[model samples]
Target: MTERKYAIYDSETSGPRPRYDQIFQLAGILTDDSFAQVDQLNIRARRLPYVLPGPKALEVTNIDPYSLDSPEHYSPYEFAVEVHETFQRWAPAVFLGYNSIDFDEEIVRQMFWSNLLHPYITNTKGSMRADLLIMMRAYSACQPGAFVIPKNDEGKDSFRLEHIAPANGFENMQAHDALGDIYATAFMAKVCQQASPELWEHLLKLCQPRGCDEILSAPTCKLVTHFGVSETHLVTRLASNPTNPKQVCVFDLSVDPTPYLNLSARQIAERMRTDFRILRTVKTNSQPVLFHEGDKLAPEVTAEVTSGESNARLMAINDHPTFKIRVAEALSIRASEFEAAPHLEAKIYDGFPSRDDERLMREFHEAASWPQRKDIVARLQDSRMKQLGVRILMSEAPQVFDPAYRDKVKRGMLENRLMPPAEADLPWETFASARAGLAQVDDPELRARIETWLDEQEAAAQAVLAA
Candidate 1:
C-alpha cells in the first residue's frame, strides 16, 4: 500500500465570517507519511474589492491595511486560484491543520465557491482533512500524559495552537502567522505520534468519513467532546441521516434510554428540542474522537457510569425496532428549522451545480478575455452560478461591461459596502461597523491608519454615488 502525505496548512483571514470575510494569507507545508517536509507554499493577497476589513481582525493579525494593496500581492481571485491549484497538485494527501476544519476550511471553500472553482476539493478527489485542535482535545482527554496541555489565564485548558504548541516544545511558534502555525501544527502531530503511536494512528483514521462509522456501528462507544473543556459521553448511534450519511445522531447513554424507547417520531422530536442534551449530532467526517468497548478510557470518564449499566442502556436503545426510524425523523425535523440563506455565498450548500454549469465554470476560469468570461457567465444554467459569476466579473473584469452598466455595478458594490439595508442583518463588515470598531482599537497609530482608510473609502463611495 502507498503511504499518504499530509498537506498541513493555515490561513489568516480578514475576519471570522467565512462568507463575508476573506483570507489574506494562506500557507502550507506538504509532508511525507512520516511528517518530513517535502514542499511548502506561502501566498498573500489583497482583500476583495467589496470586503470591508474588520478593525479587530486587523489589530489581532497586525496586518497593515495599506500593505494589502501593494503591487506584489496577488488579487483575491488570483490568490484563490493559486491556493486551489496548489492543493490540487498535492492531491490524495491528508489536508491537516490546526482548527482548520472549522475556520480555515470554510474560508477555502467560500473562496473557491466565490471564484467559480470547485469548493469540495480538499475532501474529495482522494483527499481528506484533519484538525490538530480537535486532535489535541481528544489526545488531552484520552492520553493526558502524551504532551503538555497548557491552561489559560482563566485556568481552562488553552488549545490555541500558539499556547499548546509551545507547551509541547514547538519553541519558535509564531501564533498569528500562517506558515509559522503550520510548522507548529506539524510539530505537534509528530509529538502525538511519538508519545502514543496507537492512539495517534486511531485519531488520524478519524479524519476520513468512514473513520468513526465502525466504532459507532457497535452497540456502545465513548466519545470525547470539547465544549470549553473536554467531556466524555457514553454514546450509542441512533440513526444516520438518510439525506446526509455523515450526520450521525447518537443517543447519550448516561441519560435514561427507557423513556425514549417507546416514543413516537413526533414525541422523540419534541424530546430532542425540550431536552437538547439527549441527542448529540456528530459529523463523522469532522474527526470526532471515539473509542470502542475494549479501548482503555480515561479514569474520570470510566467512573461516571458503570460499564454494565451503560452497556445495558445501549442494548436497550439498539434493540428497539422503531427507535432509529423515530430518531431519523427527529433529525430531519430539527434540520428543517434552519431557513435557506438568501445570500449567494451562503447558498453554497443549496445543491450541486448541473453538469452543464460545472463545465461552464471551468470555461469561465479558462476564458482569456473578460468579455468571453461574461458571455460564459450568461450561459450558466444555475442562477447562483450566474450571479456569482457576475460578481466575479464586476470585481475582476468590470471593463468588459458597457460603461453605464460597469458604473452601476461599481456603485452597487460601493453601496453594499458602505450602506447595507437598515433592517437586514448582514454578516459582512461595513464602513459604519468598521468605523465603530475604531473605538476599541487602543493603538493610536493603527487607529489613525484605519480611520484614514475608512475616510478614503467613504469619499470613494460618495464619488461613485455622485457619478
Candidate 2:
C-alpha cells in the first residue's frame, strides 16, 4: 500500500507568529500504515500566563471562554507534558498535517522549546514529516480533478480546509477548531490517496528525508521539486565539500555556470548571495525529489521539463576534474562567513541537556507521581535542567513548592525574558489597514459583518479598560 503510518495533527494558536503566539488547543490522530486511526488526542490548554490572546484569532476560532477558564483544562506545562508523552507512543511515524510544515509544526517546536522537551521530535528517531497541502497542490497541478478543488472569494482555487473540506464532501463546519481540522485533513489525505494511488505514493516519497543522501552524492541529477503550485525540474551537480554534508550545494545545468566559474571564489560567492539561481544549494535533508541521469520520472512529467540533454550536461560538469573541487572550495568559504554570526544559530535545541542529562530528564518525565518527578528534577546537576525542573514543578504541582521558590521562578522567567513579548499595538494597527481594505469590498453583507466585528472588538477593549 502507498499509505504509511502517520500521526495527523493540528494546532489553534493565539496568532500567526510562532515565536510570539501561544497554542491553546492541540488535536491529533494516530493512523496505521494504511492511514487507519489507532489513537487520538484532543487537548485544550489554559492560556499561557505570558501571552494576551489575539482578538482576531479568538473571534475566528470562537473558543468558549468558560471552557478556557474551567479547572478541567490543562495548564500549558501540563499540556506540554501530556503532548510529549502522547507523541512518544505515536513517534517514529510520519508527522502529518494539512499545511503544518509552515505553521503547526513550528508551534509544536516552540511549545517544546518552552517546556524543555525535544523540539525536533518530528524529525528525530527515524520519523518524518509530510504536508497534505503540498501533495494536494502537486496533484492539482499534475493530475487535475483527482479530488475536489474549492474556489476562494475571487473564484480562484484555494487549499484552505474551510473551502476544501466542504467541496470534497467532508464535514468541516467547525473549520478553525483544532480537532475538526485534523479530522478533515486526515479524510482529505485518505480521499486523495484512494483516488490516485500512484501520485500519492510519489508525493509521499518526496516528503521522506531518506533518499536525498544518495541523490545528492550522485555525479548528475534531475531534481524535481515543487515551488509554489508548480514543479521545477533542474539538472544539478554537487557543489559543496564533503566537510559540509549538511549544506547541499548544486550547479543548475539548464543554465550554464561556466561563465561564473571564471570569477574568483569571493566574486562567485557575492553573486550567489544576491541571486540564488546563479548557483542553487538547498539543504539535502529537505527531501528534494532527485532522478539521476537515466532514472525514469512520473508519466505526467513532460519532456521539456526533464530533458535528457540537460542531465547529460550536468554529468559532464560534475565529471570535469576541476569543477567539483572549485565549487566545493567556494561553498566552504561562504559557509564560514555564515558560521561567524553566532546569534543566527538555531535555538530550538537550547533546553536539551547532554546525553548524560537525558537520563534525569527521562526519569522526570516518566515518574508516575508528580512528587517523584519533582524530586528527580530537584536532584538534577545541570543548571538549565534544574531551572526547567523547578518551573515545571511550580506549574504542575504548585502546592509542593513554597511560595518563595514559586515567586523566584516567576521573577527569573521575566528577568530572563523567557516569555514571549506582546505586540502592544496590535489589531488597531491592522484594523485601520483592514478598514481601508474594506473599501474595495463590493459585497454589502460581508462588509457589514467585518465592520460589526471591528466595532464589537473595540467595545470589548473599552469595557476591559473601564473595568
Candidate 3:
C-alpha cells in the first residue's frame, strides 16, 4: 500500500488578478510530502466587486459569469466547508502549498473572515503550513536549474516556471487551472523528494509535525494574518528565523529594519553576548541611521567589525535592501561605498537596538511600489489570454484595412477561415503604433476618410460584378 502520506492546501483569490476578473478561485490540496497524490479540493467562489474578466483569465480559466445560475454559485464559506470536510477525511496533519502564504493563505483568511458569520479558522494559526516552492528553493540552492530565464549570450539565467519543468526533465502541463497547479506542485515535490531522499524521508517522518496545530497560540495565527501567501522562496526565509535577538551567527536568521529601535546597550549586549556601545544616531529622511558608538556591527557575519579596535563602528544593515549577507570585515577595508560613508547607503549601516528591528529582519515588511515588475513568470502565466486577444483581433480586424493592403488582410482572413476583412476594416499594426494613431488622429477626418474609402471599395466591387 502507499505509505501513509498527505498534505492539505488550497489557493484563494479575488481573481487571478491579471488573467481573469471572474469569480476568484481559491483551491486546496492534500498530498504526501513527497507529493504522491492523496486528495484534492478547490474552492471556486468569489465575494468580489464587478470587474470584467481579463483577456488572460478568460483564455485560461474560461470563466463565464453569465452562464451559471444563482444557486449554482458557491459562497466563500460554503467552499471553506467543503475544504474542511475533505481535510477531515484525509486529515494530513501538515498543510502544504506553492506560494499559499501570501496569495493562498491571504485569500483564505480574508474569505473566512468575511464570509463565515462566526468563522473560526480550524486549520489556521500554527497550522502545519509548508511550501513546496521553499523545498524547491532550498533544493535549487544546493542543486542545479533553479531559475527559469532565457538569457542572451551574456551567460545569465532567464528562467521562468514554464521552462522550469522542461529544464529539470518534467513536462510543462496545462497551467492556471486548479488541477494543473496541483499537478505542478506535486511535480516539484516529487523532484525535491528525488533530489534529497534523506531529507525527504525526514520531512515525511514529520509530515504533520507535532506543533501542527500551534494556531492555539496567537503567533501561529499571525502566519495566516500576515498572509505571506507569496511564492515559496519568500516564505521559507520567513520561517527558520524567530523575531528575537541572540548572540547567534548572522547566518542563523535575517534581521529586519523599523522606524525606531528600543533595545538598550545592555539588552543588545545580552543578545549578542558582546559589549554594546551607543552608535551614531545619524537621522535620515527615510530611516534613522545609527553609526556604531560601540566596537562594531555583528562580528559573526562581517569581518570589519571584528578587527575594529575602536568601538566607533556604525549600526547599519537592519534596513539593507536585499537582505543579503555582508562581511563586516569588508566594511573597514572598503571605505566610501561601505556602511561608514556619509551617503544614504553608508548611513543605513548604522546600528539599532534589536526589537521591532528584529521583527522586520524576520519578515518582509515592505511591498513593491505602484507597478510591480512584469517578470517572465507573470507573462507566461498570462500566455493563454495574450494568445486569445491576439488571435481574436488578428482574426477579424476591429475595423477594415486599407484597400491597398488587400493582400495583407486576405492572408489573415484565409489563415483563420473568416470572411475576408473589407478594405475599410481597421488595419493591423503594432500595438504601440495603433495606440499612437488613436491618440492624435483628428477624429472627424478619420471618420470621413474611412467612410469614403468604404463607399469606394463597395462601388468598385459592384462594378466588377457588373463586368
Candidate 4:
C-alpha cells in the first residue's frame, strides 16, 4: 500500500469574508503519513483591482499591498491557477491546516470560484480536508495530559496556533505568516502524534468521510465538540438526512430519550432550536471528533452519563424508527428555512455546473488569446460561470474589450470600492471602512504607510471616474 501524504497549508487573506475578500499569500508543506516533510510551496499574489484590503488584516499580516504589485508576483487569477494545479498534482493527500476547515479552505474555494475554476478540489479527486485546531480541541477535551494546552489571559484553553504551538515546544512561530504557520502546524501535529500515538491515529482516521461514518455507526460514542470551550457529548446516531446522507443527526444520550420519542418533526425541531443538547447535526464529511464506545474519555465527561444509561438511550433511539424518520424530516425543514444567498459569489453552492460548462471552464483557462477566452466565456452555460468569466476578463485582460466598455468596467469597480451603498451593511471593504479600520492600528509608522496607500487609491478612483 502506498503511504498517505498530508498537505498542511496556511493562507493570509485581505479580509475575513471569503466571498468578498482575497488571499494574498498561500503556503503549504507536503509530508508523509508520519509527518516527515517531503516538499513545500509558498506563493503570493497581487491584489485584484476590485478588492480593497482591510486595514485590520494588513495590520496583522504587515503585507504592503503596493509591494505585491511588482512584476515578480503572480496576478490573482494566475495565483489561483498555480495553487489549484499544484494541489491537483498532490492529489490523494489529506489537506490539513490550523483552523483551515472554516477559514483557509473557504478562501481557497472562493479563489477558485472567482477565477472560474472548480471550487471543491480539496474535498474531491481523492483528497480530503482536516483541521489541526479541531484536533487540538479534541485532544484537550479527551486527553488533557497527553499534551500541553496553553491558557489565555482568562485562564481558558487557547487553541490559537500561535499560542498552542509555542507552548508545545514549537519555537519562534510567526503567527500570521502563511509559511511560518504551516511549519508550526506541522510541528504541533507531530507533537500530538508522538505524545499519544493511539489517539492521534484515531483522530487522523476521523478526517476521512468513511472513517467518520464507521465511528458514528457504533451503538454509542463520545463526541468532542467546541464552541467557546471544548465539550464531550455521549451521543448516538439518531438518523441520517434523507436528502443528504453526509449530514447525520445525533441524539445526546445524557438526556432521557423517553420524552422525545413521541414528538412530531416540528416539535423535535422546536426542541432543537431551544436546546441543542436534544439533537446535534453532525456532518460526516467534516471530520467530526468521534470515538468508539470502548474508548477512554476524560473523567468528567465519563461522569456526565454512565455507559449503561447511554447504551439504554441508544437502544431506545434505535428501536424507534418512526422517531428517526421524524428527526430526518425536521433536519430537512430546518435546512429549507435558510434564505437564498444575495450575491453571485455567495451562490457557489447553488448547484454544480453541467459537464459542457465544465469543459468550457477548461477551455477558458487554456485559450490562447483574450478574445478567444472572452468568446468561450460567452458560451458558458451556467450563469455563475458566465458572470465570473466576465470578471476574470475585466480584472486580468481588459484590453480585449473596446475602450468604452473597458472604461465602464473600470469605473464600476472603482465606484464599488470608493462609494458605499445606501444600505448600512456593506459586504466588502469600501474606502470609508478601510479608513475606519486604520483608526484601530496603534503603530504610527505602519498606520502612516497604510494611510498613504489609501490616499493613492482615492486619487486613482477619482482619475478613473473623471476619465
Which 10-residue window of candidate 4 scores lowest in summed lDDT? 294-303
- The true-versus-predicted C-alpha distance at residue 229 of model 2, in Å, is 3.2
- Taken over the whole model, the C-alpha lDDT of each candidate is 0.85, 0.68, 0.35, 0.85
The model with the greater TM-score, 2 or 4, is 4
Candidate 2 backbone collisions, by pair: none
- Local error of candidate 3 at 208, Å? 10
Worst 10 residues of 2 by lDDT: 340-349
What ordering of candidates by TM-score runs from best to worst? 1, 4, 2, 3
lDDT of 2 by residue, 1-467 (tens): 34457889999886676755678899999998667789999998886533445445555676543355457889888899789878878888889998787788888877876676777778788678888887777667656788888778888778888788888888645788888998888888888888788767766666654566566566655555555445445546556555666567676666655666566677767766876753777665454555555654332333353456665666567556676666677787787785432221134434456776677777876788888988887777777667656766766686777777666665544323322234333322233444555565565665666566656544654453354
Please write out the lDDT profile of model 1 over residues 396-441, one tens digit for every residue: 7778899988888888887776577666567788887888899978
Model 4 per-residue lDDT at 191: 85
Superposed Cα deviation of residue 289, candidate 2 (Å): 4.1
Model 3 spans > 4 angstroms off: 1-4, 8-12, 16-23, 46-62, 65-73, 117-127, 145-160, 199-467
Q: What's the count of clashing pairs in each model shown?
A: 0, 0, 57, 0
Which candidate ranks first by TM-score, i.e. highest?
1
| C-alpha TM-score for every candidate | 0.95, 0.76, 0.41, 0.94
**Ranking by lDDT, best first?**
1, 4, 2, 3
